[model samples]
Target: MTAADGVAATVDLNGNFPASPPGSRSKKMVRDGPQPPADPTAVGVKKSGVLWADLDPCDEGRAPTVNGGHADTASGANGANGANGANGANGHHAGHDDGAPDGVPAASDRIDGVLEMLETHPESRVLVLYTGGTIGMVRDQSGALAPLRNRLASRLRSSPTFHDQEYAKRRFGDSDTGPLILPVSSEGRRVLYTIREYDPLLDSSCMGIEDWVRIATDIKAHYEQYDGFLVLHGTDTLAYTSSALSFMLENLGKSVIVTGSQIPLWELRSDGRDNLLVSLLLAGCYVIPEVTVMFGARLLRGNRTVKVSADSLRAFDSPNFPPLATIGINIDVDYRLLHRPKATEPFKVHCKMGSNVGVLRIFPNIPTTAIQSFLAPPLKGAVLQTYGAGNIPGNRVDLLEALREAADRGVILVNCTQCTHGRVAEVYAMGKVLWDIGVVAGADMTPEAALSKLSYVLSKDEWDLATKKEMLRCSLRGELTAPARVLADWDDLDAVVRALGAKPSQTASLLVPAVTCAAAARRGAGPLQAVIDAGADPAAATMEGRTPLHVAAYEGNLEAVRLLLRHGAGVHAKDRFGRTPLVDAVQMDRHEVIAALRGSGAHLGAANPALGDKLCSVAAVGDVQRLESYRLAGTDLCQRDTCGRTPLHVAAQMGRSAAALFLVSSGVDVAAKDLSGLTPAELASAAGHHALANALRSRRSNFCT
Candidate 1:
């Protein structure tokens, strides 16, 4: 905040992130029978090891979310959204029981759902979770389950259907499964596409925590290198996987979308094509920063999403949270629901999660271990999910000790309210107790923020107890609001007006006024001839700061200054800031004005609050030629300002090139320094004027230097 140091703007990641393939591919054939398509509404269902369901309603041509109402479905021949999963080195699973219900669905029904999603959310990252679905499965020699003969990359390459308007054609190329990976650019941001078949021998049904961990790791590693992420996850446990990842990542500034389809791609009429396409579009260009799950056309927060129906395509719903965005015919992003990164510092990958961290959901009568386990030594942090405004069930001694001990040990204990509208700090005394004991308050911060904050803190190299406590008290983002109050006034109008009106002694016409006043007092004819020529009463002069004579005096007008003094104008009259005419003249370094005042016998050195070092700088830089007239008037040459910078110091440091030669020739010290410890020579050198510097360095005339 200081003048020397300003705030740093956050960095933007533009050149980084992955890109898609370019060009077309030749047709490739696969000898495989398509499996029955699963009902989109089925829950916990996996068809050919793939899950496809309509998670939420969508807006026109956009993904559906909690905030947006239903978007009209689109009708057309749809193109894949061009979203590709990371390289899946582990191959696709084969012969797995496709999680579809017993009925065969027309391929057109599935495609219709996907087309609607693609049209609704045109700009998104669509991850096609190819978990050996109907299209991927083919019979091996042993009649066992295995991926079809053709690779997904080769399939994408054969078709030029995937393309975004902003991408350069050269930036994309053919893929292994025949589906071209198209890299799109928007407003300088980029996203890359590649099928998940990089894992040449794995399947989604066989996916475990390690697989999820790997997927999350890949996303995190590339996050700084990219703006968003899209994951191809099996729909069987898609919600669980999404929720797990939502809780895992920290300070996620990009989007993480998990999506898969119900039917296989090679079917006469398949839903997988549109679903994969829509998911890809949603993941690639949407700018909301958070974790999301895309099924059919709808996108939901990974953690908040729940699979509601077993067969119908629209499947996921965010019960307690609003959808960050909706894509049906058009993408409508709700900025409010999305979590944005504030620092833009850089995306950091925190692969390690303190699995030991516990969450205690407070109910009316929870047992002691619920609180006790949180304070245990092994625990790094705890999310004390409390009622509205962080109210505890009861202030038990055990609970208090658990909370206090956790905080004292540098374990960040966060208080997140059960209610949604307000934060914990505003309503409860219990919240204050936690704060007093060093427990951090999570005011209005979503569970996401609390979890993310805790992970961010614990992952640091230095987990200092004091630092953690301080970090919690301060805001990382402008999320918290402070109370407002009134401030006191410090007006200086009177002072400024007085300064404006004051005049220096050099302009004061006092002598002539004194003569007239003397003549008047003696009852003389007031010099009838003198009075006539005088034109007006010289004694009728201004003593306040605004006299016409005072104006001339301060301006170094020696002729006018002397005329006023001679007219008997008072010299001791003080301006509003208590400055006399002599003080004003001396402050301005107006030697002629100073000389004129002294000629009239005015006080030379008196108390004056208005005179300062800055005024001396003005004096040093002002008209130095006025100094010659002062000498003729027999004025003192040894006078100094508050900083002990005499008129000579002013003449040497700030004196003009011509005036400087005159002053030094007249015996002024050119090397003289003020209280700032800067000599005239040093000042010239600092200013980078080489000639002036050389002049100051010459020892022959120390006066000029």
Candidate 2:
């Protein structure tokens, strides 16, 4: 199928393409015409289509007529109406000059017309390698969809959904050479991309180790020219390709996204648009240096993914690991979870891949002969999917003997769990038996990661067996979590302290917040008593001036409060907010803690005469009655703290909805700005309190009226 045929099929599927009005040239003529002029006035105007009036800026009263006719310069005369133009080839209204009077161009004109504006802006260059995928599939003469070679670029250029004429008009001319340029605006920068489609594209199911090597080699060739890359592929084996690429590319310092869709782009309800658009944007804009799979609004580490469903749109998941990023109204990236590449390391590719690895799933009633046949010669490594927690039936001595024989024959066997989650460890007696027989534990690694890593390891001919075993246990490319330290004996608490990087005598000097210690008490009495018995100070205060007693009282931790008081913790201590333990307990409605604090001689109200701190404290704890009392006492309603946060700001930021409602009812300034110039409503929105923010906005509007 030709590219034009693909585009025509898409247009027929949608039935959205409008015909040209009378006297206008055909859509084909627009594409064949000379390139539009560089001037902003002529940039988005389709010369063969509608005739539009270009309003005069100097003489605002007059509007220019169609066909280059002039109107009255001073009478503010209206010109004769021209035929309405059909939608432009780029999916924008052509020659509609409504915005010409205000000096702001129409949406269609702004598509690629922003080139001059982008001259001073930074550009992120992306290279998209379009391999065969559903995104590039087109129907043939018999109406069956298939991969079309040399048609992807043409289809993209002709489709308004992919190519915005205005955006195309803004290309940085005479500066570079490559395929199609796609413009994307994100994060205050312009992303320009070039698409390079592969010849005789192979389906993802047919993709192999050699194909992975080819992809890696291509990236290595163009590494210096582009900032990032996007690979369009079939979804059947997308996860495998991503995994292979992850290991094949070493010390990669740029983002490489593997993405495809289940639906073809020529369909009306296709998911290809969002998937391709987001992949392009992320590739061009972000600095994530790992091979990742972008699908179903998630950015997952490629090696950790598995195809969980064949029919669902959300077909892939990283069961053992959380996604690195999630896409919503905003793109939320967990930077702490992302692996940061060292600046000193240079990018390289390891093209050699071992293909002799296999997977064996253990099941009940399995014959010993079957196991031996599978583990026969030529299998360099195998991933044994053992029962829960890496356990095989110990009573099946014959099966165990076959595995032992395989190991004795120098075959590397990795033990992973059949379950989607949890780690394989020597918790069971059967597990210990496998461990004793030279089976390596694939701790918390998904099957995909285990198999891929095994192949990658066996391919390294220079490395010895011991080195490969050690590397298997260690985390090498963020593929697996390192094995945790097993401190079997806790008889010596001092040793535990030393292991935690603290001296026995200095244990009490631990600077962890007292509130955190109080929260930790909920886990068990053992950890709390260990800290206390190790000479930990019960009166330690965080930088916020909150003591263990204050946090205990607020959290209603009765035993923790008793322990702190018995250990010489002060009763009259005040926080930096001028709040006492009694105040915190009372505001939190912890009746037991309130009684205990009162018995310890704690007092209520602020520790000082600062009205801002007192009001903010009351609002933070939802003490509506106390706030009302302060308002009745003639205290400033809009008082601000040292941080310039008003009581309303405090209530909104802390999600104290009732307190915010009370303050609003008391006629407080809802529009009062904080130190950062955000109003209470904006603070609530930033804090993710949508209901509170909406209420505040509604109240502010009512007050303004």
Quote the lDDT for 333 in model 2. 64
Best by TM-score: 2
RMSD (CA, Å), each prediction: 33.1, 25.0
Among these predicted structures, which one has the highest lDDT? 2
True-structure Cα RMSD, model 2:
25.0
Tens digits of per-residue lDDT for model 1 on 1-705? 110011111111132211111111111111011211121111110001111121111000111111012110010001011111111112121222333356733333333343332222222223333434334554579966466544665665454445432222212111122223444333122223545553543565676556657777777544422324566555566665665576456445456777655555545455656666655655655444466877666677675565666565665665555566676667666543444333312244455555556666778767778677646878888777888788775557677776787777777788877765567773567767767777677766555445555655565657576687566555443233333222122133334434656433312233334443333323223342254244443223333323333444555566555444544344433332223455456544566666666555444221111112222222344444444433333333333333344444444433345555555555656666544455555544443444755775673444322
Cand. 1 TM to true fold: 0.39
- For candidate 1, give the lDDT: 0.45
For model 2, what is the error of residue 523's alpha carbon versus the real structure, in angstroms, after optimal superposition?
Answer: 43
Model 1 residue runs over 4 Å out of place are: 1-192, 198-213, 220-228, 234-255, 260-275, 286-291, 295-322, 334-340, 344-347, 418-426, 429-437, 443-449, 469-705
Per-residue error for 175 in candidate 1, Å, reads 7.7
